[model samples]
Target: MNSTYANGTVHRYEEIKFVPPSNNHKTEVQSKDVTILPNKNVSARLYLSKISRKNKKFPLFFYIHGGGFCIESTFSSGYDSYLHKLTAQANVLVVSINYRLAPVHPIPAYYDDSWDVMNWDARGKEPWLKQHANFSRVFLAGDSAGANIANNIMVRASEESHFVLSLVGMALLDPYFGNGKPDVLWTYLCPKTNGIDDPRFNLAAHPKILSKLKCSKIFVFTAGKDNLRDRTWTYYETMKKIGWKGELGIKETEGEGHVFHM
Candidate 1:
């Protein structure tokens, strides 16, 4: 599908149509793209992959891709690589979600779509999840804007106890709002009215919701030069202050920008 840029230019954003290149560590795994109807006829593509194993039930890693909440797909090269690595190293089922974009759908639309997919998967209501996912050991992960969605999903799930997502680990890569001080470059690059501080995107507005997250291990990766460094740090601090019994891993890489997580 194509999208219209802020400059009123319509750009073609191609759907993920190619098989990812195979890696040395992983066997050519089973992969398929399926559509899930979250609300009425509104649907999003869910990319599911499995690494063959003998007896042990592997952990589940659900990943969300980053594109400033408006671009990219689950099959982007960087995300595809990351999933391959996670599967090779952890030997877990990796599922990447393609949420609805903004501008056309706007804030909360992405959140809603994410929540619907997550809830469906967590409840084993989705056929793919029932067949492939091992619910006992689960992890939530995301990068850039996708990191924001991952965090929000955890918060919402914990607050309402909507679905029993027994997530033991979480990995957030350079999480930030589009309007924070560090996000000045992003604002200049793609100016928009509703951003990080907006009530819709503001994580602070739902403190109660976030307080419910009780993960055992939280790993955060951020670059020193990234605009969202401060925000990511603050989030890390907040999670600790809220009594989250988890270990934090902050890697400060030099010369890496926002998309480095990819």
Candidate 2:
């Protein structure tokens, strides 16, 4: 893949692609985009509706999109479509971010962007978040690499005083953690990490991190045939073993692959 190149040689591939924001006004969900990182031009799409503004007490859904820290974005067609529907059906405002990719931005870049955006929301710096979103019921959700980002974010949120988050729940769909040998792409993207052992890549590798999740519950979904199934299931079991106080939920489909719900 072009993203694997670390040499100075430029690879112009992986151009940013996006599907336009939803335009159907029949549904209550209204969408808008705003920059979270001005220097990098990184942005997040916010889905808020008139109903969400009724009392400014609607649940907040903060979403992270999966691309193995290499590709894809919040605005990608598949992701955008999903968010649009989710916002309406769930009757919540969703903030889906576009973080920096790897082999170009490197490890921690993705995490940093999410962290910054979360803090911005925590401080009520974002107009839409402070105006219409309910912080007390904020839920984090993601698929694959996005789930990894959400998990990492939750861990950091628990220990950091800077981020005043009211995280109520986390939904990780087919998270990208590994059980054994790390995927070559994982190493390629996060070259600074210690392959699969890094807590960021495999949470099971560090059970102590489980206690740091600052949420009431975590929902993990894994498909039977997904290569990462064992690792995710193990994480759920290990969390229970550790007496993680939060309610844990796990779901699996017999013949599905990673993130079949998407």
Candidate 3:
């Protein structure tokens, strides 16, 4: 790989540890890994309350994790613990996606992997999803860079009619977006892009796409101490200003760092 793209290559894999699927009795949440794309070695960690009967269906929470789009996984320990509690308490089935990282696969690879996973599950190929998930109440969520991916996916879903899943809501936690300025990280991931002015990084630039989000509701969360906090507020304000026909909400955790809720 080029030296410029070799940023955080070693530290990322060393500091973050992967957590295997677990069947924790305390939370009553059981998780297992299922392959979504065998050819790419891509997979997702499925989390659901084991106590919840198969006859009953729960909202599907499609999640993506964050590590600057270069690190982290659906199996990361932090995400695993957080999702376990979320699945148990919220009574929602979680599909945490593990997308290919950058510097090797680069920009569109991770985005494409996430979209492919959604399409794969919508076909009813997984028994857990088919039997226990309520497809009509699906929600897409992510934190930091994953939030960026979630936003892009939502925009694409709105444009395409064949995405079988019903995405009723989306939640973004400290989403990584730019304020109409050049962003070094985004450019590093997508080398050929038009800097941060690209709609993928700056959603506020494209009012039409923001107005067309397929989901009817959106929740944005930011940490007061996070450097990206202001950008999130800008996104919320832009969404409201566009007269997008969606119920929107935002919250900021006082004195917290990025993604502190997780």
Query: What are the Cα lDDT values of the candidates?
Result: 0.66, 0.83, 0.89
Per-residue lDDT tens digits for candidate 2, residues 1-262, read 3633446553647676677776657776778888878997678998985563345767888999987777788888788888888888888888898888766788888888998888777777677777777888889999999999999999988878766678999999989887667478777776777776888887777888887777999999999999889878888888988899988999999999987777
Better of 2 and 3 by TM-score: 3
List of clashing residue pairs for candidate 3? none
Report the number of clashing residue pairs per model: 0, 0, 0
Runs of candidate 1 exceeding 4 Å displacement = 1-26, 38-56, 125-128, 178-209
| lDDT of candidate 1 over 59-136, digit per residue (tens) | 778888887776777766666666666666566667778777655665667778878777767777666567767787
Error of 1 at 140 (Å): 0.7
List TM-score per model, in order.
0.77, 0.92, 0.94
Error of 2 at 167 (Å): 0.8
What is the Å distance of residue 198 in model 2 from its true position?
0.7
Collision pairs in model 1 = none
Model 2 C-alpha RMSD to native: 2.0
lDDT for model 2 comes to 0.83
TM-score of 2: 0.92
Residue 93 local lDDT, model 3: 91
